[model samples]
Target: MIHCMTSFAQSERSALCDTFLEVGPDAPTLSGSWRTRDLAAHLILRERRPDAAIGMFLAPLAGRTDKIQASLAQRPFEELVDTIRSGPPKWNPMALGSIDEAANLGEFFVHHEDVLRGVDPAARRQLDPAEQKALFGVLSRMGMLTLRSCRVGVVADSPGYGRRSLRSPKDEHGNVVMTGEPSEIVLYLFGRGEVADVELDGADHDVAAFRETNLGV
Candidate 1:
């Protein structure tokens, strides 16, 4: 299990690096205000500089994280991509295969799509059965937390992975079912719904409301 996860993480990292090279530095990403260079710096910081990476989720540390990421973003774009492609430094726990798999598989996958869909909204990537199952596993684990703040009930329906009830309705719009390939569902769950290839199944109002609500971690 761990070995599979590690391979997925490593492959996604490598592919994302290749994308960075292809897109250049100024390309946009689903991460708001983040260009490809900014995203690369973020990956570098997350893997190589945990101290700054915490600010990504913590309010108080956000300024510091921003400062550090901005500095890292200023490095030559190719160098940043190279550093990311090379993986974490030996001194970091992320250098360990287990930790890298646990920490980066979903993250790199999401950011990889961020760049892909950001560059072309119509773009889509087909995942193999194993990849789909792996991503669906991530969704099954994180779905509740990711959608807890949503105002309506949420059900995720990924074909071949079974369905999961992520949240209960908090409004009149009722339940909204999100249907998509696992990777697309992951992107939607991570706040990239605008570009994620997911379909919301429910009443028009319910679906609209779900989309309007900020749905992500």
Candidate 2:
């Protein structure tokens, strides 16, 4: 399981990095208040902070926004990518232990889409099924489907599986119905790109707002 999860994360990291490389320096920033550049810096900062990783499972909601801001002055994108490729400063077995493997998978999966959406949409098709399943399971747990508080929803069109809502925020109205291949839905929910190609529906204003609000620690 550990090996599988590691491979999954690496694949996602590669895709995200490639997408970032494709994004021109002047690419339009994401529509939300926060830009994609901020998200990229945040991920790199997280990988370097040992304390954050150790406490991430228990305090996943803590310090993320601050960490991103604090690391804004980090080295250029090229240097950051090289550091990430080198791996986390010190891998914590406990951190992975606190969260289910599926949850960890979801983290990388969603974040990968987040980065890709802000940068390059064309590369999104590269993600694999194992990665999508991991993200789908996590989004469901986060309640993204019911259009409640979740920002994304998954509509299962396959036989034997009734349509189910995944993640959204509470007090939210309307829905982002993600239909088509499960992989596409997973990528879209993670913020990879627009879901116009899928059978999804929802108010763009709400999603843009949710994306703007900082949810990380």
Candidate 3:
């Protein structure tokens, strides 16, 4: 059931892979205290190994996932990075078209940002117009699921990119509106709101509730 590859997503993935090699394995990432080596191992395991990938999202399998990732991390840095740059193996679902595009675009894009943001919050890449559209397209379809934890309705407005509600039926605190560029919205959706250059409008309590709730996976 793998879908078509999104051109923007694939391009971003390729760029992320290249950057990983350039920065070296020990470089720090926005993933808490994880470095590039940990991120590289994560990509390999998530894409190439079904067991490991499953464990990543399932609490019961998380320990197993960690062990496999640690083992992969122990490999020679150059070798591990090269595998990521080469992309997933052909037999892997991630090697398929749209599935890779939809699944990896955010993973790579966010992780790519994680690397840069970890070093400097001001260091931001200029995304292409099409890339922005692609991101919003993906968000439009998945925003609800990503923001399911919100007790209040959350409306996102990104101008040319269109708008969508991450939640519906205003909660006790009512609805909150988030305004920003699509890219900024994407970052906020992925749990980077504190530093994300987005504006919130609504009651303080409602806004806080929206911000505090888990926004994405």
Candidate 4:
């Protein structure tokens, strides 16, 4: 089971790598101003460049990360796409099976959606049961850290699969249940709630607060 999960995770990342090529460098992304090329540079730097990767969690290093990413952006568009398609280099720790699974499974899933859903009237991508389960499992492990800012407790439920608490929020009104496919729930938790096709059930204020808050990794 462990090996299979790792294999699937790597496959998903690899598939996204291929997709980056198909989307082209100029494709817009739901993620800020990043066109596909910029997104690719960010991904590559995150995995291979330890300094930049840590910058994501360490505010002080963010500028350094941005500078490096900008330099990468100056590279030819096709070169950027091909580097992303190639995945992280063998020497990168992200190439390790367990680390790769932990880091890139959700990263790829979210960024892949970033490209696919960047447009107006975006197309929805359907996940197979196994894919849904994979994302759910990852979320259960990391939800608390992701939603630490939320003021209301969050319970994510996917019928016929599983249910888990994203976190215990401080909202006195109590928790709210977000029901949807695991993929959708994960998307919502990752701050893409506006585009995630899920139902948020709670007090009007709580639901509204959830929507208004900026939730993401």
Estimate TM-scores for all models: 0.87, 0.56, 0.91, 0.91
Please give, for residues 146-165, the per-residue lDDT of candidate 3 as tens digits.
78666877788888888887
Q: List the residue pairs that clash in candidate 1.
A: 153-169
lDDT of 4 by residue, 1-217 (tens): 3447576566766766677777778888888898888888898788778867788889998999889998898788778766776777998877777887887888888888888788543678767678888888888666765776778888899997898887777837577899999888877878788799899899898888777766777
lDDT of 4: 0.80
Model 3, global lDDT: 0.79
Report the C-alpha lDDT of model 2 over 127-161, residue by residue, as the tens digit: 45555555445546544332343444334432223
In order, the Cα lDDT scores of the candidates are 0.85, 0.50, 0.79, 0.80
RMSD of each: 2.5, 6.5, 3.2, 2.2
The CA lDDT at 204 in model 4 is: 91
Model 2: weakest 10-residue lDDT segment is 153-162
Deviation from truth (RMSD, Å), model 2: 6.5
Clash tally, candidates in order: 1, 22, 5, 1
Q: Using lDDT as the measure, name the better of candidate 1 and candidate 3.
A: 1
**lDDT accuracy of residue 76 in candidate 4:** 89
lDDT of 1 at 90: 95
